[model samples]
Target: MKQWKLGLVVVLGISGLFSGRAIAAEEIILRYGILERTVAVSDLSQLAETGEATSQLQSYFDTAEVPAEEVQNMLNSDVTVDGVNINRILDNPLGDVLLDEVSKSIYPESGSAGRQAMRAALVLSAVDDDRITVIEVLENYPTSRVVLDTERLAETYEDFQEVGGVVVTVEDTLDDVLNVIRILETLSN
Candidate 1:
């Protein structure tokens, strides 16, 4: 009787474990450049809590040929191409053409640095417009730059009041800049 009772209990326990509710999963569509992907996430909260979402997102960006790190660096740094400082050209009437030329000169290689340089060049070209300079665009749209650089512009200015004002002004236009970067990356491949 004791042996039979132990066997029954073990069987019941095994069945109960297997009968537990299944985890619910949802499908999310992510668009990167020209590529679109649909991923099923079983537990979003769990993934976020574990900090695995970032790695998953990074893998997606890698598939799209846009190294997230490189893009981040390019957006943060002061970039110059073909002997012309991008900031100086931003205000010039011929900035668009100059930026295009610079983009063309970027080395066509698959390495992370090369790909990043190419993306940066393309982003600069995209921002080149006759109506407004990059600074003016940022100034007009205050929240846009925050999307690109969550930490905000890291560069410090000697005149905090004047330079800080300029940074704030440009913040609004950062979205347009990012849009241009996305468009260029999409069309490149």
Candidate 2:
């Protein structure tokens, strides 16, 4: 009976991990000018969690114009987010503009699905912790492949702050709304 219960739990856990989503982003293609390098998402995640960059990622680190510490700060910083509010915000006009700006920097290979994928990534990342970090967004990205345009990444990071601020404001304003956000989040999905 014990063994059977353990097997069932493992199966359920695995199912929950994937749910109905596509394969999460595995690698990011970083592009700068004519140069491009494919980096594993796992390596980036590790570097964000721990401050050490691996040998495989070292060369890219060396070539980066931004200091390592700043890079770490950007990756490690996070915002409290709600999936339902994120969904609602991204469907509006201002959100569309923000998405356009952000999408120019980090997007899937297709390019067109940038906003949708970004929304999904942000929502999925916040599902468990209500905290969304750059690393988590990259990890939960809805595509198996993603692109990071170095020229625009820093600028996009700034634009992303605006969206984060909006989320914070919404959280403050919507606090006493009687759990409507939670219900909307489910219905939106």
Q: Write the per-residue lDDT of candidate 2 for residues 6-110, one digit (tens) a residue.
A: 453354345436755444789989787677889899888888988777776777767765565666677777877764456566677877887778778889987
Give the runs in model 2 whose Cα sits over 4 Å from its true position. 1-22, 175-189
Q: Lowest summed-lDDT stretch of 10 residues in model 1?
A: 142-151
* Alpha carbon deviation, residue 42, candidate 1 (Å): 24
Per-model TM-score on C-alpha atoms: 0.22, 0.75
lDDT of each: 0.35, 0.74
- Report the error of model 1 at residue 135, Å: 13
lDDT of 1 by residue, 25-108 (tens): 133334443555554432223333343445665677567665655434433233222212234433344444443333232222
Model 2: lDDT of residue 20: 58
In the predicted model 1, the residue pairs found to clash are 138-169, 138-170, 139-169, 139-170, 141-172, 142-171, 142-172
RMSD of each: 24.9, 7.9
